[model samples]
Target: MATQLIELVDGPLDTGKPSKPKFRTVRKDGQIVKLRIVDADSPNFSADLTASFQANIRRARKENREIEDDS
Candidate 1:
């Protein structure tokens, strides 16, 4: 299987400074899924924003498993 990467782009943010962070979600084949800009001050910012990405991965894995099971 190819390696998957969910990497944070740019260096660590300074807490004293406020800025939106961009995240790069890459597929196992090194293709980029999406680039997301997240607001740090939003409620449940991390969980809310990443939920869809996580769900997509879960759904893909489930589909793959189903396909393999049928083989």
Candidate 2:
């Protein structure tokens, strides 16, 4: 059995009002597994989210036995 992960990222457009990075994770079964929001003040929100997403995928893969990312 194999599972995949996906992340949906979004953010506020207003620069003055900083908001957390919006993202969601899904499995190969097309089920949403998790949602994460990075710090709004962080300068490297994109990088942080990307890293976190990768880590999550790795962890999920290890725990699920095997995961194939479709993202």
Candidate 3:
């Protein structure tokens, strides 16, 4: 399943804040999955996001079980 990331229409929430939920979407296994990313990639340093983002992702996955939720 090739993943297709949906670029956020609006970038990360509030500048300079690293521990906030940012909306992001990706296509996994031919389905689009929405997420709240709290992690940031690095180019120079390695001390980036923690493991807390997983919880949010897990919850999103659980809440959004169907391919489409018209609610």
**For every candidate structure, what is the RMSD over all alpha carbons to the true structure, in angstroms?**
14.6, 16.4, 16.2
Indicate the residue-level lDDT of 69 in model 2.
43
**lDDT of each residue in 12-39, candidate 3, tens digit only:** 4433324444568999999998765544
lDDT of candidate 1 over 1-71, digit per residue (tens): 99999978798533343234566877867776765556658665756456545657888899999999999
* Model 3 TM-score (2 dp): 0.28
Name the regions of candidate 1 deviating beyond 4 angstroms: 1-45
By lDDT, highest first, what's the ranking?
1, 2, 3
Which candidate leads the pack in lDDT?
1
Please list all clashing residue pairs in model 1, or write none if there are none. Answer: none
Name the better of 1 and 3 by TM-score. 1
- Against the true structure, whose TM-score is highest? 2
What is the alpha-carbon lDDT for the whole of candidate 2? 0.64
- Report the Cα lDDT for residue 44, model 2: 70
lDDT of 1 at 61: 100
For each candidate, give its TM-score against the true structure: 0.36, 0.38, 0.28
> What local lDDT score does residue 37 receive in model 3, on the 0 to 100 scale?
52
